[model samples]
Target: MGFHGIAKAVCRALTVRQDGPSLYDVCDPLLLKYQGGDPHLGKFYRTALGNPALRPLLRRTGLPALKDAERLTRLRAALTAARDDAAPDWTAIGTPVAELMDDIDVRHPQPPAAKVTARAPAMADIDRAIRVCGAHLLRSFARNGFIPTYAAFNLLGDADISGREMLMALTGLNARGYKNSTLLFALARIFIAHSPARALINPPWRGIAEPMWEPVQIRHRSAYYDAFFTEALLGFVETGLASSDQAGAARRAISDMVEFCLKTSAEEVPSHDGSTVNVITALAPGPHPRFSRFFAQIKQDLGFGIYVPDCDTTACAFSAATQAGADDPILDQPLVDFYRGYQVRAGANEPRVTVPLNDHIDYEGGVVTWIDNLNGDRPYGNDLDPTLNLDILEVSFRNLKRWKIIETPQRLQTVHRIIAFQRRLVESGAFKNPRSHIYYLPELYSAYFGRCYAAFVALPLAAQRIIDPGNVFALIRARVLGYVKDELIAHEMNPFDAALALMALAHLNAEIATFTPALHCIVQNLGEGGRRGPYKAYEWNKMKTPTRILVGGPEVTSAFALMSLALARRRMAHS
Candidate 1:
C-alpha cells in the first residue's frame, strides 16, 4: 500500500480510539507496501517494539537501518543486490555525506585560517587556541557515547585528544541545530560513510528532530553546511503515501517551530504618565507550552520592558543585482498591523495603511519603542484595514518588565562588565590590527569589543527595516541571529562556531533541520594521527613554534602553546 492507504488506516484508528494499531499491525503492512522491506530493517524495531514505551507511540514503519559499521555493510550489500536487477547509473549520486573511507589516503585538510594570514603572536595564540579547541571537542564526542569516539574507534594513538573533543562538541551542537564549528570537516567524513534513509520515515527524535533549524532561510549561504534535513524533508514529501497526511505532519512540525518563534504582542497598556510607571499587562503564551510559560513568566518578572520597533524581515527584498522578485514571506503571519503602527508613529496624517497581525507574515518581537505619550485601546484593527494595535506593544513591554532576567539587571551589568573587561585587551596593541579593527582593548576584551561594535552597527540596519509590529519578532529574532551568525562567519565559518550559533538560535525560538548534516560533516572531517595511526599531517603550530623559538623565546613559546591548550579547553566547555 502507498503511504496514503497506510496513513488513512492509522488516522482512522486514531479517530475512534479503540486501542490504536500496534507497531506489528502497521510495520509489516507498510513494509510489504514499500516492497518487501529489508529484513535488517525489520529487526531494528522487532526488538525495540517489545518495549512498552515504544509500543504504539513510536513504532517502526519498517524503514531500513543505516546506523553503525556492520549494519551499514549489510545495507550496502543489499543495495548492490537491488541495483543489479535495475540498470546501474553512475554520475547520479553526489559526493558521499561523510566519505567513509577506511585505509584511504588520509590528508588533513587545511583549517579555514590556513587559506590566509600573516600571524602575530596574539593571533597565533588565538589560532592555536581555536585549533586545539577543535581537536578537544572531537575527543569529547568520543566520550559522549557516539560511535566515532576516540577510544571506541581505537583512535587513541591515531588521533589526539583535541580532535576527538572537537568532533564531539560539533556533533552535540549539530544535534541541537547548528553547523557553526570548524569540526564540519570531521563530520562530513561520517556522512560519506553512512546513510539514514530508513531512519527518515519514523525519526527517533520525532518533533524535536523534525526541523532543527529554519530551512532555506539563508539560501545558498554556507558552502560547508550540510543540507541533510532539507534532503530528508524532500524525501518525505516525495515518497509520502498520502500528500495530506505525512506532508501534513511535516508542515505541522514546521508550523510549531515557526509559531514557537513568535508570540502575540499584547492587548493593553497602563497609564504610566499619571503615576509610577504603572505597567501591568498580560502577554500571550508562546506556541510551545513550557517555553511559552517560561517566556510569560520572564515577562511578568521583568516589571517593565522596552518596546522595540516592530518589523518583518523574513522575506527577501528584490535587488536589481539578483533580479529576484520582491520575495515571498517565510514568516507565518500577517504583518499589516505592524506596518500601520509604523505609519502612525511616523506622523502620517492618519493611519493610512492597516495590516493584520494575524496575516501569514512574521514580525519582530523584541525591543518595543518607548512612547511615553502613548496609551489607550483605540480600535486597533478592523477587518477592512488590518493593523497591529500599538496597544499590544504596551502590553508586551509591561509583561517583559516582569521577566526574571531583566529583574537581575545587576547580573546583566556584571556580565556586560566582564565582556567589556575581556574586550579592552586590544589597547596594548597585542594583536596587530592594521585597520584598528580590534577596537575594544586587548585579548578577550578586544574580541568582545569588536563583537559589540558589530552588534551596534547591525541593530538599526536590521531594526529600522521593520514595517509592521506583527513582524517584530521576526526582525529582532533575525537581529539576534545575525549577531551570532556574523560572529561565526568571522571565525572563518567553522563547525565550532556553528554549534554555538545553533544553540543561541534554539534559545531565541524554535529549532530547525539544517544542523544535522553540518554536524555529520564535523564528525567526518576530524584530524587523525594517534592510534588511527600516523596519518602524516604536518604540525602547523609546530612550524611557527620553532620559528618563534629562535626569533623570540623558547620557554615563552612553550608556555604559549600550553596556554593555548588550556584556553581551548576552557572555551570548549563554555561554548
Candidate 2:
C-alpha cells in the first residue's frame, strides 16, 4: 500500500476518542494481532517493544517517536492489532509500518528545537534545602539510633547503606556543634561492636578467609561493608567524641583488622581485590603508620595487575598506593596491561576502554555480553544491571594521571579514546536508554549521572569540550530540576531515594531552586521522635508475593537525609 493508504489504515485502527486515554495507554491492534493467545503476552510485548535493534527502525521510520502525533496514531493501531489478534506476523507489520513512517518524515521534515539554559538556583532556595534536609534527617533517626535507608511501603529494616549514611551524617553534624550527640554516641557504639575481634582465629575455608568488619545485626558480610565501616570508625575516632578507651579500641580494631587481612593465607583468600584495596585506602589516612607492611602484603597477594572480577579495584588500589606515598612505576605495569586488554572497539576508527562491574559473561552469536549484578541475581536477569561505563571512565581519568599511567603514549591514547566513547554514550542516549543495558533504577541512574557531572566539572576546560561539546549538563540539570519539582508536588519518593537524588543534584551544583521543593516535602513528612519510619524494598513479581516487604528503618533514612543536607550545604557555600 502507498504511504497515505497505510497511514489511513493504521490511524483508523489506532485513533482514540477525544475523552479517551492517550494512544500509548490504550490497547493497540498490532499487539493483539501478534501477542494474543499467549499466556506470557506481557513479556513478549516488552521484549518486542523495548528491543534496542527495533528502536533504530522505530526512530528511522518515525513510528514510535516520542510526542509525534502522526506516529502515535500508527503505533496505537499496530499495538491494538497485536493485542487482539490470535496470531500475527509482527515482523511483517513492523517492517511495512516503519517504511511508511520513514517515507512521511522524509517528505515533511520537522526538526526538534535546540536545547536551552536552565534556571539558576537562588540563595533563598539553597537556605530552604539545607533547612528541610536537616529537619528530615533529625526526624528520620530511629529509636534504636540507626537511620532507615528507605522509607516506603516495601522496605523497613534494610541497612544496605546504613554505615555510610551514618558516617556522612556524623561528618555533617560534627561541623555544626554536634547537635545530636546522642545519635553520634549510638553510632560510635554500633561501629565498635561490629569490628572483628582480634582474638578470633581466621576461618579455614578458602571462601571465607578474607578479614572484614561484620555488621552487628546483619548476617551477610561483604567487602563494601568492610571498607565503609572501617572509614566510618576511623572518622568517628578522629572526631575525639568517643571516650579515650573507645577511641583506642577503635584504633586497635583497625590495626587488628589490617593485620588479619594481611596475615590470612593468600591461597585461602577469595579475590575481593577491590575490598582489600578499599580497606588499605581507608587506613592510609589514619594516625597510625603501620599499614606499609599490610599494603606490601596485599600487593604481593593480589598483584598490582587488574583483575577482571572488579574493574574499579585496580584504580582504587593505585589511588590508595599514591595516597600512602608508596606509589611505584613498577607496581603500575600490571594495571597498564589490564587496561590494554579491556579496550572495546566502538567503530572502525574509534576504540575505548570499558570496565565491567562484574564477571558474568554470556556469548551469543559471536557477541560477548557482560552481565552486571549490581542488584544481584534477580528474576528479571541482567535487565537491571547498571552499565557504569562512565563511572569507570571517570575513576580511571581522575586517578590514572596521578599514578603516572597517562605519561605513556599508549595510555594517553586510551584516555582520549575513552573520553570519545563517553561523549558518544551520552550523546547517543545510551546512558539513559532502557534499550541499552546501561539504564538503571532512577535513583541509581541519578547517582551514576552525578558521577559524570562531577567528573566533567573536574576536567580541564579543553578536555570538557572534547567530552561534552553539546553541554549535556544543561539537560541533566533540567532532569534533576524536574525530579525536584515532581517530588515537591507529589512527595511520592522514598526517603533513601530522595536523599540520593538530592546528593546527585548537589554534586552537579544544580540550582538551589530545584532542591527546595523536595526538601520541603521531606520536612513536612517527618514523624515523631525526628524519625521517618517504614522503608520500602524492591518489588518482586513472583507469584504469591506479599503486598509489602520491609527493607530499611529510620536509621538509614535519617542518615541519608542528613548526608544529603550536608552535601547541599557544602555546594551552596561554594556557589
RMSD of each: 25.9, 20.9
Question: Across residues 1-575, which tens digit of lDDT does each residue of candidate 2 receive?
Answer: 34565455345333322232222243233332352343233333333233343222222221134246665565455444434446544443243233332222111111122122244345465344334433333333222122223212211111111323223222322111121221212211221122121012111111100111122112111121222223334434443344576566545544443332222201111222322111111112212222235443432232121111233323333332332234344234434334433445434312111212111221110111121222221111111123344444554545555545445666555555554544444444444432233223335455556655666677678666654566655665556445434432234444455556676777767777666544543444444223223221221110000111222334334434544555665666666
Off by over 4 Å in 2: 1-218, 225-308, 312-340, 346-387, 416-425, 428-439, 459-491, 521-559
Q: Which candidate number maximizes TM-score?
A: 2
Q: What is the TM-score of each candidate against the true structure?
A: 0.20, 0.41
lDDT on C-alpha atoms for all candidate structures: 0.25, 0.35
Residue 330 in candidate 2, Cα distance off native in Å: 11
Best by lDDT: 2
* Candidate 2 root-mean-square deviation in Å: 20.9
lDDT of 1 by residue, 275-300 (tens): 22212112122331222354344323
Error of 1 at 159 (Å): 36
